[model samples]
Target chain A: MSRRVRDRKRLEGYLPPEGVPISFSIASIGARFGAQVLDIALTYGFIILLVYAMVTTGALPIEAMFALIMLCVFLIRVPYYILAELVWNGRTVGKRIVGIRVINAEGRRLTPHQIVARNLMKEVELFTPVTMVFTVDAMSGLGVLLTLVWVLAVLIVPLANRRRQRLGDMVAGTIVVDNPRNVLLPDLALSLPAQGSVPHVFDFLPAHLDIYGRFELQTLEKVLRDPVRGEEPPDFGQISRTIIRKIGYADPVRPGQERAFLNAFYRAQREHLETLRLFGNRREDKFHSAPGS
Target chain B: MTDAVAEQDKRRTGSSPDSPAAPAPQGELLRSARFRVEREGHWRRLDELVVRAEKAGPASLSYDETRELATTYRQAMNSLSVARDISLDRALLDYLETLCARAYLVVYAPQESIGGLTGRLLSIGIPQAVRRSALPLLIGFLAMVLGAVAGYVLFTGDPGWFYTFVPPDLADMRTPEASVDYLRSTIYGNDFDAAETLAAFSSYLFSHNTRIAILIFSLGIFLALPSFALTFYNGLVLGAFFGMFAVKGLGYDVFAWLSIHGVTELAAICIACAGGARLGLAVLLPGQRTRRDALREQAHDAVKLVILAALMLVAAAFIEGFLRQLVQDPKMRLAIGWGIGALWLAWLLLAGRSDEKQANEARGGSAP
Candidate 1:
């Protein structure tokens, strides 16, 4: 991958407390927006339900009602962001569901101070400006204009940066990143046919295996592993023909046996690359000349 | 076989005396298979632990499971490094990297107990931060004072200047046109049921002031000039309001009225601005350090001040809501205002002094 692309995707070279430099993908703006929308919906939905309940109960005097609602919103919304993040290690309910999380930009354990600072900043960057826009005296052009400007500025900040950090994130030195949970698949080489057991329909000799490298092997494995779909599956016949032609194999691959031919070639190529790696003759791609060749 | 094929095959699967797979050239794929077979148990175990931890908190793990997690994490890290060096399977390496990253996040997460965090925040963290950013605090305070003086002078000289300094919505009916008696009523006003409305008033004031404080602090990222400007403008509003009353010779009453909560509220604003000011100044002039480094370093204190200021605003809101209109005596108002101010000053200055050394050590221990 290109450095710029990798940098855009992953937070490179982050040293965790363990002192090992690791990297994680930066969450896409799309995911962040989705999480934010979910959060806003949930919080606002909650506040609406609460206000409805309070209004229906009539236990509170009309004069105190507004204040009670304000108190409820302030109490519920602020703590929901700050305390939830703290307890869940920078994940809110929406963030957890969306599979993204906030982390310290410096790769330290995220501090409570950072969490509070960032969330409070949301008051300015998002909540306040939005409320101001609605409540602004429409007659005063400047008031509406200023609110719009603030809203636009906040929106643009994240788009302009590689980290996709909004102003709050910048101030608090935090970034939102994808929470990955990839499972390790069994080694593909383990599926290779056993020696001296069921004679394979096709065999890949050393010459055929050596013609390809790790990259080609992986590409071929991907093709082989892809499940056949619909009436017209991938043209394994054409693919096998190309590989056979490229490797200068004299034998012909049977029409229906193309998949088996490719599978045999994949196993052989992977074995060849793994053996080369053990001997420190790692081949990155077809363009990467094998060691001593 | 062709000479080249035999030669390549022989070289590819070099001799291994202890031969299980090494005996046959085709069987040399055993290297990666063998590696996975040997260590798959640890990888699987670690994966299970991480999944469980993520689903629930680490507390869900048994003591033995926790110990196993540590060892498995180390082993995973080692495997990742070695795989990067020698493994040709990109999938395996990618899997290990992800595993290690997740494990690391869980393992080294800020494990500071909640009680310790709260104690430190109230005692050492907030006060030390306040003390460290004294320069910004002074600058913020002075900006407000200067703005207040400018506003007072301008409004006193020209009544028309009231429109220029204060927004109509904020000024409410406390305009130049209103009678002194009417303005006085606002200060001692209880037209609305005080007990019923005061709760709303307190919450409104709390949310509003907290929003402004947060805004000032966040705006500090833009070189702090905005923070200074915002603080000064607030001062202008106050000065002009006071000027209107001062013109009618109810200046002391107005001062007393505001002092009921103004001391805490205004101080909280200044402290919040100071948080922003420190942030702006650090970015503007990061001496001997990169701007990013300076910002990251200074942000700790700035955020602390903002949070502390926010809490202070909450208290100010309550006092203003409950007492400003209820307590009719000017002398009592002034005493209470100053009393609250004195307590805040004392707390900021002295609350964490006893544990200064201990606080530093505790903070250092928790920090990466």
Candidate 2:
């Protein structure tokens, strides 16, 4: 079941071998559409520039004219999306600006065949309907209907799933995700009897503190910040359990006091790490080295 | 030899100043804040290093800088997990998530062109796939021949069979009443408009036939019935045309006209049908695996067949438009048609085998 969840997100989560989860929020449809629009605009701009260049080279020999026309046909037919994603590490310029990236849906690296299949399918998904409209005068009624069906089939695909993946994403086994950004730590204030006033209520271990560092610290902070979604109940129990298992902590927190327990752990770990740093030693991850003399 | 720490020293100015009252001889809240503040410098420093690396490949990073980047990356990741578990600050969490995402991709995803996969596919993949589907291809070819024979026999017995099978627009000039002079001209015409008309005709055939090929391959998802019907219908049209010409005593002339491109064009159509049949069989009969697994296994070959069929149709269109026009003699057309048929057979059976051996040798050389 955990495997299914990981697969659904196209997550390359930290296994025993890999050592950490790779998580990113999937990009919503609006952002993807915006990038596509920018790409289309650029492609058209390029074609017009080529045409202008061809016209300026006046009286191009007959052979040159044929070559120019062929160039235009090639430009018109090929979408540069494949090349853009290939060269830009899964980002086109528009995608880079919008803070999204394409990745294989299976949590594997992108392959050339997948890239080609997805882009070529775009001809049927987007371009066929467009070209049909452009050549409407020549098409029979059945052809028009078929074109409409093709467009409809592709348009509804993104809406039918939580991932907001189009037919292209499904066929290519890829997903779009937000680019990573820098994390800030929130002001941590959960009202308990100030510091030592509640000393008997909980306990900590320096070794327990040693199990995590800044990376997991920020991730925990994000979870603690937003415990509830729009309608679903909060899942703090699972989150707490995962952290316990991940860090090899010996005991689970009291059932309902998951948040408070996590906060106490947070304070203990921070002080423990800061004390070490003061002694000219700074621990990083679970495998942090050498104790201060 | 090592100025990475010095480089990091110069960029340490970006950490927020107010964040640092954090020696934390005090409150739990104060400690977490100090945690954030103290670690903020590494995040900023790593981000700067990453920006440089992203701009100028990872190889450009100094040894110390690379170590710092790795150590800082792990630390940032830990901070993200901690922040999510304990903090309620949305902005901080968002920043952490984004930073982690960027860092993960830059660290893990390979940096290289994928040109080799495409090159391999074009050179060896399609032919090998075609070779594997030989039995299904033969079966599909037999089905089309059966359909053609049925259409020819039925049309010869009754002219209405031709009208029923062949669309009026396509059969416009090829009807029984078309003059011998006119029938001859379609194969060996000299008018200026003849070239233009043939060019338009070939493009129309290319799009129409290619569309059918793609549709047939995809429609195999529905137990392959539609694919069978479509292929049979295509054969029926050809048979009906031949049957009509036979009735008018122009069968030999018409055969010559068709032979030049028909062999390749028809073989392509049959391959597409076979691709669909192979898919149907996968879903209909799974020897040991689940049905879905069987379908998945067959899909690559099916896609290769679809793509190859489209390519052959394009080649056929060119042959039909230009070369067929030039070689209008009946014997020459038959020779060219049979020659192409033999070449396609030999190529499919033999071409990619050599490449397969070469690739295996290359892999062997690298393995040890």
Candidate 3:
């Protein structure tokens, strides 16, 4: 391949692993959900504690206590979901910790309007009182039977959806997905080495290059250094060949000659530079750094 | 020179080049490069350093590492040609965080659902309270109304009975001639002009009624007896006033005049009283729950009712101050009152119904 073409290919972003299926274990999903809850609880808990302390100390009125509680609950819970979904990309405090988040069925960030629509359903959940009993004893007796109707009306709608969306989600134009692992890579800082003495050269890459190039470089670094630690190390030659094919390269490297080929190729460029210096009269040294120097 | 040659030899071997014999310059460069790469590689290891720093009291990550990670992520984002790819990356990060949050919830608070257990309780708890209180509220209102009417009729039959019911302080204000002239004059009597007097009277009555309603609702700590007594007394006075007028052949006119503001104001007072009664009852009979628990539950219901009461009072004040005064004809007044009553009924039943479907949708939707 021409040098320019190779450089162009190198600049391409890291390709996501195909067919890996970004499915998360139920345990992980639960952890993420829990984290969000904790975040809210902590936030609201602090506010409530502050209010309670004030009220008890007579710094605030008892009526203010009620108002404050109501305010905190509304402000914290409503915006917690909406803003987190919209801005934080669906992971609340707990969700962030557990490595799970909400996304569209197609695995995309939700819009603000969608977040608002989904959150307003909270009022419905607040106003309706009979729905909870339905869950407790759907099959027990006549009361249970009646409660079942109410429960069915509320809960059944969401169950019918492929994405398990409730009426609000449907109206709001959103879906919740398990936070896919690929999104976590950036936050995980997986591209950079975690610990070492060497000054990273990749940092010098100009910022104007698109995210794809940066990702590619980072991925290249990771792949080079980490190299998947179990079993026999992946045959770099075969792997490189497969990557090349996947990326639309036509030439294939032969087995057992991959390392020699790379070394010779780098060396040939260095020798070519020497030839340029010895024969062709270039005013200044044309080649600064030797290949693989 | 010997050491430099040895270091070069070591570099050729590539066997842990940080060996003691490695040349200072080469070793330093290699070490720094290796360190930088390793340091920048992963979040988990970086987090370990942070954790250690925290354990040791205070620590922070290197600024260079922070900047590098940020740049890398930004680059990844910019590289995406397809919105779908960027979305997927965002989704992955979101998922990871959510997983962490969910794990925390499971460990710390297993009971909370996305809608929250409090929300569930509110859904069931409020309506249940309302339904339970509805019978008592209706019965109490009806009984008071009937008692007032009965007392009015009996007292008017015997004019002397007025003194028995009326307090000594208010007795002198009554007219012996049994006239509408006296009541209208009393209502309109003031240094101000008739319009001003009427307006001020309406405003005073409207505010007084509201204050009384608020007091009844808020003084649940006193077991609500004061509020019930106040309701009963007001009802008796209303019945007596109407019965006296009916005896004088002015009952129809009086009914219209009273109802112009009475309907909403009375209803609001009753609602407030009902809220107070709920609180009192919760205190008196803490059924399956403890007193505090019952009080808390009752307080929630009472608050909703109080809000409803406040709305009604505002309607009452508007009618009393503007509508009632503008339409002096008794028939017109009655029609307006009835219209307001109908409007209130419609609202109580239907105001928030349009969003019911949306609310249900929300409940059913995924936690995302």
Tens-place lDDT per residue, model 1, A1-293, is: 11234534756356654555678788899999898889889888988987888789988787678987787677665667998888888998899989999988776778887788778778777776777877987538888787778888888989998788887787678989899777776565555332333333455566666677777776776565535565455688789888888888877665666656665666557667766775678877776655665
DockQ of 2: 0.14
Write candidate 3's Cα lDDT for B1-368 as tens digits: 11221222122211121222223343433321222233233433333333333222221336665454344333323222221221112323343333322222222211112345335433443344445478447734764586587669767778665665666555456543546787665443333435544445555555555556655665443466655776776677667666766776676777888788788888777887787677678778889878645665566566556556766886787677666657777778888888788877665554545455675588679534
| Model 3 regions lying over 4 Å from their true place | A1-293, B1-132, B157-180, B184-203, B221-224, B354-368
- Model 3 Cα shift for residue A85 (angstroms): 28
Predicted complex 3: CAPRI docking category: incorrect
Clashes of each: 1, 48, 80
Ranking by TM-score, best first?
1, 2, 3
TM-score of chain A of each: 0.82, 0.55, 0.42
* Model 1 agreement with the true structure over B141-211: per-residue lDDT tens digits: 98789889988999999988899989998888889999989998888877756677887888899988887
What is the iRMSD of the candidate numbered 2? 10.7
Instruction: Report the number of backbone clashes for model 1.
Output: 1
What is the interface root-mean-square deviation of candidate 3? Answer: 18.1
Candidate 3 chain A, run of 10 with poorest lDDT: A201-210
DockQ of candidate 1 relative to the true structure: 0.38
Fnat, model by model in order, equals 0.42, 0.18, 0.02
lDDT for model 1 comes to: 0.79
Model 2, B102-218: lDDT tens digits are 666666664555577667776699888888787768766876888788889888888788788989998877676677777777757754235655565566567667766766665
